[model samples]
Structures are given as structure tokens and as C-alpha cells.
Target: MPGEQQNTSELTVEELLHDAAVDSTDIEVFLNALTRLAVHNLSHPGEELLCGITLLRQKKASTVASSSDRAQKLDEIQYDYADGPCLKAAREQVLVHVPDLQEDARWPEYRETVLEEGVRSILGVPIAIGSGNAAGLNLYSDEKGRFDEEAVESAQQYARQASRALSLAVRLARHRDTEADLQAALESRTTVALAIGIIMGQNRCSHEEAFDLLKSASSSRNIKLRELAADLVASADPSSAGAHFDR
Candidate 1:
């Protein structure tokens, strides 16, 4: 109803929550959906909205999704130059409104590049996830002064919507990453256990002594317990792993 959004504003919280639950397994898919939904709800004729979201990871920023290549290209320009409205919005946790790229002296290098590419205006609104991860939703236009007071005011509403969905997606991604790390730790512990068992059987040593031997070998060889265990397991023959451990 707002632009060409199919009345996304009318979507009940329950409905949004239900859809989010369905996408809990894939945060990228969920984040992309949120960007598309925001663009659809806020786009206008002269504005010709092309939207993208930049995600900050490990002190680096990358454009994760975009409604069009136009937005993606602009994101790259900002990233390559390492300074732009979008970066400020994400890093400073403030809204950055660039009325005209040609006249904006805030980021001289970025301004010249986008201005050459026919970009007239930009609005970067920070998407706060509340988890110390910075992100920004960027909207670009080809017409100067497209994002006036009323326009920005309306866009703020969509920014909040995108932020909510993206925040949940971020949490989902973190949960998935945490689960993977735990699984890896469990697997590594299991490998060490198996290695210890092999050492006990081969060396006729107590369980504690076997573990100590494994630790000694790990430290001596400058290898991880998992790597050493894998090597031992690889060298196992039908005869005995005793010879392997002796090495």
C-alpha cells in the first residue's frame, strides 16, 4: 500500500514472527528477505529505490544483500574507499542523509565516484542488532533531493521494520555458529578419547598415563590433539596401534 509493497505494513506481528520462525535455519535468506521487504515498502518514482544492507564482521564490512545491482555497486564504492555515509551510519550508529552526492563533501573520494555514476542522493540508516555487530540499510536514488524531510520520516518506519527482522536473523546466525563450534569441540574431544584408548591398549599404560603421553606428543610435535589423533587413527592397522604410538 505504501509503494508497491503488497501492504507489508499491514502484516501482523504474529505473521512476521511465523515467517521468521520458518527461516530460522538460514539467516542469509531471512536477511535478504528483510531488505527486499524494506525496499518494496519505501520505494518511490523519482527515488527509484535500490536498497542494500552492509554487515560488519571482524572489523570488516561487506554488503550482504541488495534489491538491485545499483545498490550493490554503491556499497562497494563506499567499502573500497573506506569512508562514506553508509559506513558512518553503521559505525557511528546514526542516520546519514546525503542530499546530493555532488555537493556532499563529507566523503570526498566516495562522493566523486558515486556522483560520476549518476547517484544523486543516499540515505543510510543504521540497523542496530544490539549484539555489537554493526549494520546499515542503504537506499540510493538517481534524483537529487529525493529524500526530503517527509521522505526520510517515512523511511524511518521501514528502517525499524528491517532492523527488527535483521536483528532476529543475526541472533539466529549466532546460534547456528555457536552450535557448530560446540559440535566441533565434542568431535575433537571424542577423537582425543579414542587416541587415549589406543595408547592405553598399545603401551599397556593406565588411562591417565596414556592421556599424558598424548599431551606430551601433542606439545612436542606442535600439533593439535585432534590432528595427532587423526594421524594415529590413520596409521592404525589390523595388528595394533601400539607401533604407531611408539613412533
Candidate 2:
């Protein structure tokens, strides 16, 4: 099985990106699919394959995705103890391999807990995505010595593929978030403008005076200008404002 050349479909760089794009902003979906595909294509000798993508930001590491619930629980155990191969790989940006957790000496508590959970082998591959962010792909197996040199090498390649796709997904997710924020800002401005129109028509005031009056009202009520405008807009149009912006 080690030297067998299976003619599986080669995962191209473009295909990974396409998968990431298809998942939209769901990091869990993208990572779970990527890791499962990686394990299936590599044809490793293992009963089960599990993966977790960790995002390191603000000096904090969190498991963002996993291929299975067992994998997620194992990762959580490591996080609880602050010592495990996955957390180490993510925090230190290194490749971590444990051939047999029962005999491993690196993490005493973690090794004991994982062995009880029927996890015998693990591989952690660092995934760097875009700027100011890094993640790790964690693989778990039920068989001991499952992740040998060849498996590790194959996992590295998959991690590279995942990195490319995850980088794009991260950027796209940020873009979507930014776009949403800008849309909300613009909508708030429009609502305020509409409220200003109402104020001008009712109080016979100029544009500047109307805005000042709105601000004064907002300050007096201890509410945001946008919130005051939204309220005013809701009062002006009983149907549109609540239907569109209340969310």
C-alpha cells in the first residue's frame, strides 16, 4: 500500500479555490470538506480521519473546524489541558507527529486522555493563510504508527492545498464582512437623510439645522444618531423602516 500508485483524481490548485468559494463564509464546511478529501485521496491506512483548522489571532488559538465529533472532542481536551500535538503545531508553527500516543512522552496528560479516546496516531500540519493569520490541520487515526514518512509528506501537500484555498476563503470572508458593514453605513445614512427631509418639511429648517436638531435629539435621548434616524424613519414609514433595517 505504501508504494501503490493509485490513479485518483489529482486535486489541482484551482479545484481547492473553487471548493472554498462554493462554501461561502462557512469555514467549518470548507475545512471539513478539504480534510476529508485529503484523507480519501491520499489513501492512508487508517480507520478514521479527523481534522481541525485553528485560527491564531490576538495570541489566541481556537479550533474552527473538525472532520468528526471525536476529533473535535480530542482537540477540546488538548485545549483544556493547554498541551497537545494540535495546539503545539498551531501555536509553534511546526509539524507534529505522534506514532503511538500510548508511548509518547511529549504530553503526559494529553497522551493519556487521547489513548482512552481510541486515538493512536496524529499529524499536525501548519497552514498559513493570508496576512496576520495562521492555522493548522490536525489529522487523527485509530491505528498506531499510521502516519509514517509517506503519510506525513502527503499530508504536507494537502496542507499546502488547504492553505491556498483557506487563504482565499479568509480573504473572501473578510471582503463580505466589510461589504456588509459598508452597506449598513450607507443604509443608515440614507435613513438619516430621509429623516432630515421629514424634519425640514415639518420644522421649516435648512439641511444643516435639521441635522443639528437630529443630533441634539439623539444626544438628549442617549441614543446613536443612526438609531434615532431609524426610529424617526420607522415613525415616518410604518412599514419600510422596520421591515428593512430593524434587523
Candidate 3:
């Protein structure tokens, strides 16, 4: 879009996504479709497309794309070192790219790292998450002067799609984790409650006092209340008496 003339392309991205299945397994399909479009620009005169999204981890960079290994490594280095384009993009929620890493001294550490890896140019675009933190995409090139203004615009268009895909993936994963946690918490609470009840009967104490006793025992002995409950349940009868439970 920025470097190439806008009148030429035939297929719109919406049409492509509409055609492709928008499921977990089909995400790669979307990525492939977008990249194919960018590749087309690259082949024609004055056009190039390099795009990629980071994996959905760390909460900060879920759907963003990068052009090369150099760019990804730059992101990791930024994460570890606490400085770089990825951090800037995440913080600002904007698109960023360096057409010539050697020429830009804004981030010397990143520049040096990519230079060492033989990368000359790079781009990063934010993946949105309905007004929240999402992943980012980075595009890189081995040759300098590969990404001009028009190319960056095309990459940005593709990045929008990547962002949506990333958001879907991350939210789904988070939901699954939340559901699992809720289930486990419910079961654990049942165990703890049962154990508390057993302690109340054994000690002839009220519910509040039973809870206090359990807390005191757990703290002093440094054993988890859940495990203590399980042991109490497992032992049953008189055999449970004075069973030394190590923390």
C-alpha cells in the first residue's frame, strides 16, 4: 500500500478470511493467505511483504508479527534486557519498523544483535485485543532497503488480521485455563470443607474454631491443608491418630 500502487490487487483480505475456516487449526491458513498476498507485492516492482507474529506467551506479545529471526531475537533480547522496538511497540500500541538497523541508533543493543545475526531491516506491528494487551508481529529482511513505506503499509494491513487471530487464540487458551482452575478449586474446596468438618467433630469445636485449628496446624507444621485433609480422609477411624504429617 505505501510503496506499491493501490489499484492493482484483486482479492480483499475479508474475502480471504471469509473463505478460510476461522478455527484454531485454520489460523495457519489465514497466516498463509495473508503472507501470500504480501508475497505478491514483493514480486511486483517496488513491493515486498515480510510478516510474522510472536507466539501467545508472556501476555505482552501475543499476536504481533516479525519479519525474521533477527527481529524475534531482538524482541527476546528486549524482554531480557528491558529495551527495544518490541517493548516500544507494546508500550505505545503502535507499528514500528527499522528499514535499516545499521542506520538507526535508537536501540544500539538491538541493532548490534541483529547486525551480528546478519539482518539488515525489520518491522513490528501491534496486535490488538479489544483495548487490551495482545501479541505483536515482526517482519525482517536479510537485505537492506527491502521494506519501504508502501511495503510497511501492506504489512500493517496483514497485521490487523494476525492480531484478531492472536486475540482469539489467547482468549480461548485463557478461558480453558480458567475453567480448569475453577474445577480444581471446587474439588479442593470440597476436600478442605470435609476435612474441616471432620476436625470439628473430633475436637468437639464450632465451625470457626475448627477452621482456626486447621489453620494453626497447617502453619505450625508447614503442611498444606488440602494434603492434610486427604490424609485424614484416607486414614479414617483410629488409625489416623498421631500420624506424623510432615509439611
Candidate 4:
């Protein structure tokens, strides 16, 4: 009963991500915070010197979203050589911690290549979103056996924060796109209305006839209706009665 109760209390990474309840501002803060945490955590004596975050696309695990040269190079190494902890963790959706590269033979090519770069240890943790595949947070250390279980757990917590932030960002981006489209539509309609009014005054025509005139002018001049409307508005003058019919 006690074991089952403890298991029930333990929350999965997905649950933790939802608990964060990310907003647009929170998304920015979360990303900045995660990067800061990674920097600080790696700054710990003997911890891996993190290059940057490398996001593994769910549709293609080999594809990576790396912001820097170092991270891109690391992703290339993992993909080309095929034996790094980052690759393993992302593929398996689990933590891969290598205490020392000198003695670790799990990935011979990777070990040789990474050690040549002055890295002695690596700790990779999977970054998952929802119920899908995972990406990786690859941490490199100059010292042997740098990340312990506690450090890995801390990294996992940060990954959870990142997931929530990403979800919120995507949602906000869609909303912004929709809002922009709607505003553009409204502005276009206003321009058309203004043009119609201008044509009515100038041609001494009905509203329907004015709109038809505006459309004919637009089609003849090969100008956007909105631009034509704006031009008509610019030509009209309030003080001169002839200004309305001038154009």
C-alpha cells in the first residue's frame, strides 16, 4: 500500500509540464530561465560545459533545432557517428549519463571524437512533449563523471518547463497570426468604403454606382482598391466645394 501510494504521488514529466500553465510572457521567461539554469548548473565544478539546447524533431529524430555552431556540431556528431548519449536519450526517451568517456566503450567512435574535443563526460536527458517522441539536452563536461543522479533530475525539471513554454508560444503565435489577418481585412474594407464615398461625391452618383466606378477605376489603373481609395481621399478638400468633383 505504501509503495503504491508513493507511486501515485509521483508526477510524470508530462503532468509537471501541464502544472506550469505557461502563458506568452511565461514562455519567454521560461526559455530564458532554462538557459540560465543550464549555464549555472554546468558552471558547477566538473559539470559539463553546455554548448546549447538541441531540439530533436519528433517526425525526424536525426533532424535538430540548434541555435549555435557548437550545438549544431554536437548534433552532427551524434547523427553521423551514431553513438552519443544525446542520441541514445532522445531515441529512448530516458536519461543517459556517462561518468567518464575514457573508460566508457558504449560509443567508441563518439568517445574518441568527443574526447578529442576536450570533453571527458556527457549527461544527456530526453526532452519530451505531450505523449510523443523526445529531444535531448546534451551536457558536456571537461571532467570525468560530472553529472550525478541529482543533476540529471534537475535538468529533467528544466526540460519540463521548456515543454510548457513551447506549447504556449505556439498557441500565442497562432493567435497573433489570426489577429493580423483580421486587422488587414478591416483596413481593406475601410479603404473600400472611403473610395466609394469619394466616387459618389465626385461623379454625383448613387452609392452602388459610386462603388462600381471605384471598381472600374481600380481595374483600369491596375491599382489595389485600397490604394485607389486612399488616393481619392487625399485629392478631396473640405474648404473647396469643387474639390469633391475635381478628380
Best by TM-score: 2
Task: For each candidate, give its TM-score against the true structure.
Answer: 0.83, 0.85, 0.66, 0.55
Which regions of candidate 1 are displaced past 4 Å?
1-18, 45-48, 57-59, 219-222, 234-243
**Sequence-dependent TM-score of model 3:** 0.66
| Ranking, TM-score, top scorer first | 2, 1, 3, 4
The segments of candidate 3 whose C-alpha lies over 4 angstroms from its true place after superposition are 1-72, 200-213, 237-247
Q: How well does model 2 score by local distance difference test?
A: 0.76
- From the highest lDDT down, the ranking of the candidates is 1, 2, 4, 3
Q: Which candidate, 3 or 4, would have the higher lDDT against the true structure?
A: 4
Clashes of each: 0, 0, 21, 3
When summed lDDT is taken over every stretch of 10 residues in candidate 2, the lowest stretch is: 238-247
Which wins on TM-score, candidate 1 or candidate 3?
1
Candidate 4 whole-model C-alpha lDDT, 0 to 1 = 0.65
Clashing residue pairs for model 1: none
Worst 10 residues of 1 by lDDT: 6-15
Write model 1 residue lDDT over 83-156, tens digit each, in one string.
Answer: 89988898888999999888877888788888888889999988786777878888898888988998798677
TM-score of 4: 0.55
Superposed by TM-score, candidate 4 places the C-alpha of residue 156 at a distance from the truth, in angstroms, of 1.5
